[model samples]
Target: MKKFSLLSNRAGALFLAPGAILVALFVIIPFFWVIFVSFTNRTLLGRTAVNPDFVGLQNYLALFNPETFFTRGQFGFSLILTTQFVILSALVGQALLGLLLAWLMQAVPKPLKAFTETCVIAAWILPEVVIGFAWFAFLDYDNGTLNGILRSIGLPGADLLLQQPFWVIVFFNTWRGAAFSMMLFNSAFQSIPPSYFQAADVAGATSFQKFRDIALPLIRGHVVTDLILITMWTFNVFTPFILTHGGPSYRTELLSIYTYRVAFKDFEFGKGAAVGVIIMLINLAFALVYLRIARSRNKEAEQ
Candidate 1:
């Protein structure tokens, strides 16, 4: 029995040891380091945290400052408000767009469907810098695709990045993000049983009625999943801010960009760490809500 137990222990370790070591090195260690560094006054180029004082709560306090973490001006809001807007706008827009694309793809022919799917996924898989540059050039005032098209229609020239920063950011996010939702909803739609739609048809249900009563309910799980996942992505979106640099007088500044600027640009390591922790907490909340919704759906499925 003792020999058998020793072999079993060795087998278990063989299975678990590699993963455990990876988790410790990549996740656990880095997380603890960030937390530790959050208590100190640090700089970007410094060998160690400057003034290594354990200033408890100071970093957190600075976050609430009217300008430091948020509005760079007198406004009482900035990162939090802008971040919420980005999350909501991107998630809702993408979900709705995905649902439409899913339904359309279902009705379309296979060849066209394949072509569209390829295009959408290609966009999603494209390098961020490539897309970022493409968007930047597209939004440029003098030699932009959009401006050129606008000029053809006799519209005035204006650098969209400067004229409408928020909407431009929102547009860029939605354009790039809708494809993931399309993929998610497309899978959900395909997973739905065809018999139900046939049954609805035999019952003389209208197209809208069938979709409303059957398709939407059946795809609820995918919708919830997409929303949660998209919310997380949109929340952590730094690419938008990086391309825009939270620019045009900080109109496009969001939490992720704000944290990056604080930690890397301003050299306030502790405050940056605080911002990073807060972001993790916000993402965690979204994750919990997603899990709860998924659990509820599972119960319904079982019943």
Candidate 2:
């Protein structure tokens, strides 16, 4: 029995070795490399670009020091704007609207449910660039479908994307990603025992009350998971590059776009790596919260 047990353990380790190696080489190594580069004076235009010298915390300090041009307020604005985009578009727009749509599907006829779900899933499955272009055409100022319809109806055509770039990107992101949240909530809501809702209905619970009391409590785990995952993705999203190009006075420039501009466009690799590290730390904080919620939820389930 001991020999068999030892063999089983060895076999399990062998089976997991490849996956562990892959993670280390791809994910873990790159993560630490980025952090290391942040402390260097790397720049594509410099003579030492091929072998950049270490600069301690100069890159990070530059992000905080107002004396440095980049750190003045542009990066701060991008950070704040990115936070707003995550909250408004991913958390409120996608998660809330997805839940509502999922709930609505429950009361709709089967054919309608299928149709609505198909439409949403279709949008979700489309490539990001394709979705961006679709929205680009949809929100185009001149000779676009939306403005054309408005003009036909005697209303003056307006350039929505140009005037409200931030909100336009938010709406676009929500429309593109809401289907994921909807599918997640749909699966979670299904796992919930129907008897809970039946009992709530019998006890004179209003629709909102039932949702607030029963649905929300039962699916709190899913909510946390979805929020964290979506928030991280939305925070790192660069889809606005296609739609807005971080232009019209940089109103919609996200942290990801800022990092790209710094590294690739501006050729300041060290500063870009610093911004990347900051973004990673923010996501790590979110991941910790997610793990805590998941652990507590697991404990509750076990009990």
Measured by lDDT, the strongest candidate is: 2
State the number of backbone clashes in model 1: 0
Q: Cα RMSDs of all predictions? A: 3.0, 2.8
Measured against the true structure, the TM-scores of the candidates, in listed sequence, are: 0.88, 0.90
- Count of backbone collisions within predicted model 2: 0
* Residues 32-132, model 2: lDDT tens digits: 99999999988998675999999999988878766644442367878888889999999999999999998787669999999999999999999999989
Q: Candidate 2: minimum summed lDDT over ten consecutive residues — where? A: 65-74
- Give residue 195's lDDT in candidate 1 (0 to 100): 97
Lowest lDDT sum, 10 consecutive residues, model 1, at: 68-77
Give candidate 2 misplaced runs (Cα > 4 Å): 1-14, 67-73
Candidate 1 vs. true structure, TM-score:
0.88
